[model samples]
Target chain A: MVPINEMKSKCRFAIILGVTLAIGNFFRVPYAFSEPIVFIANDSVPMDSITRKELKDIYTGKTKLWGNGDKIVLTFLKQTDVYAYFLRNYVNKTPTQFVNYWRNMVFMGKATFIPKSIKEEDKLMEYISSTKGAIGYISSNKLIKGIKVIAVK
Target chain B: MKKNRMIINVVFSILFIYSAEVDAYSSDTVINGFITQGYMKTDENNFLTDTEEGSFEFNEMGIKFSSAISNNLSIGIQFFARDIGDLGNDDITVDWAFADYLFYNWAGIRIGKIKIPHGFYNESRDNGIARTFIFLPQSVYSDPWRDSLLTIKGAGFYGYLYGLSYQLQIGIMDAQTDGGLAKKFNDITKSSIESIQPETAIIFSLQSTDLIDGLKIGGSVSKWDWKMDLTIQDMPAKSDDEALLWAISIEYAKNAFLFSAEYSIFDVETPIDLYVSPTAAPYRLPYATNNVMEGYYGSISYRMTDWFEIGVYHSIFYSNKKDRSGKDNVKYYNWKDYYSWSKDTCLTFRFDLNQNWIFKLEGHYNDGFYNGYITDNIDKDGNEDVEQYWYLFAAKLMYAF
Candidate 1:
C-alpha cells in the first residue's frame, strides 16, 4: 500500500491544509470591535455630514422636534453587523433597509419605538453617560470618555 | 351586539389614550405601541379558503399608534384583531389613520389612511422584523390586493439622501374586490351588485444602502383605477378596473450569513365572471369571468447558526382569465364561454426560536377559481381544473419596548 506517489503527495498536502483552515475560520470569526466607534452627541448637537440623515432621524423617533427645540434621544446597537453597518452607512438604508423603513415608521402610526438596541459597549457607554438628548453609535473601540463624535454622510 | 360594544369602546379608548399621556408631565407627548399575537394551523386543502382537515387559528391582536401633533406634526393609528372562531375571538379593525410632516432628515410628508405603496410587502406589511415568514408572499404579499388595507385618502413623500431612499405616492379611496366573491354570469349580467367608484392610486419606491456590504435593494410600482358597470360596445364604460404592480426586495445579514428575498407581479385589466350549474339541462354554468391576472414569488434565507435557521419559499399565480375570442366553440357559446389559465403553487418553511420566538410551516397548491366563482366545475372549459391542497402552521411571540 505504501508509495502511490507518496500517497498522492499526502493527499495534496491534506487538500491544501483543508482549504487554508476553511478560509482561516471564515474571516477569523471576529469583526473587530474591542470598542471605540462612538458618536454619542449632545455636546450641543450641531451636526453635519448631511446631518447624518438628521442624526438618524432624531435618534429613530423619526425626527420629532429639533430644528433646535431639542427632544430626540436614541442609543442603539444590540444586533451588530457593526451596528447595521453604521446605520446602513449613516442612513442610506439597508440593515434590512433601515429595518424596513423603521418597520414602516412603526406600522404607520408614523413613529415611536426602535432604538435602544444594546450589547454592552460598557452598557452603551453607561447609557451614553447618563442620557440627555442622547444620540448613539459606539465601537471605534468603544470610545468611552463622555461620548461625542458626529460627522457622517 | 353593537359590533361587540363598538369593539369594547375602541379598546377602552386606546387605553385611555395611553394613560392620559402617561399621566401628563411627559412633555413632548410621545407614546409608542406594538403588540402582536399569533398561532395558526390549517391543512384541509389550504389556499386561502379550502377547508379540509387541519384547522387552528389565533392571531388575537395587533396595534400601532403614534402622537405628537406639532413640532412638525405627527399622528397615527392602526388596529387589528382577526380570527374569531377559536374563542380567541376577534374581528376588530381600523388598519390606519395617518398624518405626518417633517421637512428635515431628508423631507417628509404623509396623509391619512395612506400606505398602498404597493409591494415589498406594502410598507413593512405589519412588522415582525419586517418579514421572516409567518405568512406573506401569497403570490406576493398576503391578504389580497388591498395590502395593509391600502389605506388611501392620499398623500405621501419620504426622502433620505446619500445612502438613497425615495418614495412618492398618490391616492383616492373606496375600492374593493378580491375574495369577497362577486357572482352573476349573464341573463345580461345581474346578481347583487356594487362598485363604489372613485378609486385612484399610484406608488413608487427606490432604495439602496451605499452599494453592498450587507446589501439592501428596492423596487416598487402600483396602479389602481376603478369605475365600471360592465362595458364592451364602443368601450367607454368607465368602471374601468385596472391593476398593475411590481416588486423587488432583498436583505443580507452579515456574520452568520443570513439572507432574504422577494419578487412580485400582478396585472389585471378588467375581468369578472360568475355562473354555476344552471340546472343540468345545458345548465349554462360556472361563470365568474375576470381576465388577465399574474403572480410571482421567491424566497431564500440562511442563518444556520445562532438559534438555528432554515427557510424556503416559492409562489406563483396567473389567472387573468383570457378567451381572446378564438372561440373554442363550447357548444354554440354555452352562454358566452370564457375560461382562464395559470399555474399556482406555494411552499414555505421557517423556524427561529430565539430573540422572541417564531416558527412556520407552509404548503399550498392551487389551480384557480375559488370565490371569483366557478362552483367547483361545470361547462367543461372555463379552464376547468380547480385543484387544491394546503397545510399551514405558524407561531410568534415578541416583546420589546
Candidate 2:
C-alpha cells in the first residue's frame, strides 16, 4: 500500500494539474480581432518597457505610483470583446471578475477611479496624452501620435 | 470618551485638507453611490429578523466622495445607511473616512476610520452590485457580528513584497453598545447585555498575488481583549476576557468560472459565570463553557452569459469545536443536539439588468439552529423541540454608479 502522506501529496498535485488543464482548455478560443493590441502610456512616463507582472500590478490597482513617485491613472474600457481579451491575456481575470476587482478598489478608498467609457480610439489616445502616468491598451493600428507605445516583455 | 473621539476625527479631517493644500494635485473629484433593496422569507426560523412574514426590511444605501490630492496622497469618505430587521433602521452614519499616503510602490500608510480586511470579501460585503449572492456564507460571515467586524477607528500600513502583499493594522473596534452582538450575547446568557467593549486589536494579513494567474491564497489573524456588562434579573454583572480569530482562504478564476474556499476558527472566553439563576436548585450558572468555534465553506460560480449567472456554496458551522454535539449542553441545560451546529447549502441566480442595475434570487436549505437563529413558535406552543430543518428564500435588486 502507498504511504498516506505521499499519497495525499500526489493527490493534491493531481488536483492542481487538473484544474490548470481545465482552465487552459476552457480559454483556448481565438482572439476576436486578428491584429494584436498594444499598451500605450503617457509621453512623460519614464519607462518604455514593463514586465508582464508589473502590467498586472498597475491594472489591478496594486501599484499606485510610478518609479519616481508620480501617481498612476488607470483607463477603464467599455465592456467589449477587446476589453475581455485584454483582461484574459494581460490581467489574467474574467471580465466580470475584473469588474468586481474594480468595484472593490473603488469602495476601499481608491480615490483616483475615473471610469472612461471611451470606445473610440481617438478619445482613449487623447485621455492618455492629457493624463500623466496613464496607461491603456489599444489596437496597434489605433496607436495615435500623442501617446507612446510601451513594449511588453 | 465620545468627545475625545470627535476631536480625533476632526483633527484627521484637518490634516487631510492641509496635505492637499501643500501638495500639487491634479484636482479631480469623483462622487459614487449605490442602493440595494431586498426581500427575505424563512420557513421555520426568525433568522434574526421577522423574515417568516416575507419581510422587506433588508436594504442598504451608500454615497461616497473621493479625490486624489497629489501623486502620493488621496482622501475619501462615505455615508452609509441600512435597515436590517430592527438594526440600523436606515440611520445615516459615516461608513469609512480615511487619508492614505503612498511612500513607495512597496509601502503606504493609511489613517482614520478604515475597513477591516477580514476573510476575502469583508471589505466589499456592503457593495451588493459586486457580489453574486444575496448573502455571503453565514458560517464565515455572520451578520450579527457585522457591527464589531466591519471597521476600525485607528490606523494601518500596507505594502507589496516579492510576489505577495501584506497589511498590518492596529486599531480599536468601534464600540457600539446597542449592536446586534449585545443582543446575541443577551440571548445566550439569558440576560440583558448593555455594552460590549473591545481592546485595541492587531490584525495581520498576507496573500499571494502573483504566484499563479487568477489564483490567490491568503491568511489573516486577529487578537483582542473583550469586556461585557450585563444585567441578569435585577443585578448587574460584568466580565473581561480575551478573544482571537484566524482564517485561511483560497480563490481562483478562469474564463467564466470562479471557485473559492475558506476556513476559520474563533476562540472566545465566556462570561456566563455572572449569570447565576436566583431561583434554580443550586442557584448557579447554567452553562459555564468557553467556546471554540469552527466554520468553513466552498463556493463556485459560472457566468453562463453576459447577463446571467448561477452559483452554489455549502457552509458548516459549529458553536463549539470540542463538543460537536450538544451533549454538554444537554447535561447542563437540556438544549437539543442541533443547537450546537448548522449546515447550510445555497443556490443563487444573478442577472445584470444593465450597467447600473442588478437583480439576484437565492434559496437556502439549512439544518440545525446554531447560526444566531431564534424561534418563538416553540415557546408559544410550549414545546421542547426546535425545528431541525428549515428553508430560506431571498431576493435583492441593486443599482450602482
Taken over the whole model, the C-alpha lDDT of each candidate is: 0.51, 0.74
Local accuracy of candidate 2 as per-residue lDDT tens digits, B160-249: 767678888889887576676666665556577677777888888888875777789999888867777767786766767667888899
A50-153 per-residue lDDT for model 2 (tens digits): 99889888888777788877877777555377787787788866566566567667776754453454677778778888988888888766636756889999
Question: Measured against the native two-chain assembly using Cα atoms, what DockQ does each of the candidate structures obtain, in the order listed?
Answer: 0.09, 0.23
Model 1 chain A lDDT-worst window of ten: A27-36
Q: Score candidate 2 by DockQ.
A: 0.23
List the lowest-lDDT window of 10 residues for candidate 2 chain B: B18-27
- Per residue, candidate 1 scores C-alpha lDDT tens digits across B235-319 of 2222345667677777665654445566665565544432223343222223332344455655554443333334445554444
Quality class of the docking in candidate 1, CAPRI style: incorrect
Task: Write one digit per residue (lDDT tens) for candidate 1, span A17-74.
Answer: 3543454355343334333355766564555333554555554553554556555656
Instruction: List per-candidate RMSD values in Å.
Output: 20.8, 7.6
**Model 1: CA > 4 A from native:** A1-37, A45-63, A66-81, A84-153, B1-99, B102-113, B116-122, B125-148, B154-172, B176-194, B197-384, B390-401
- Pick out the ten consecutive residues of candidate 2 chain A with the lowest summed lDDT: A8-17
lDDT of 1 at B223: 75
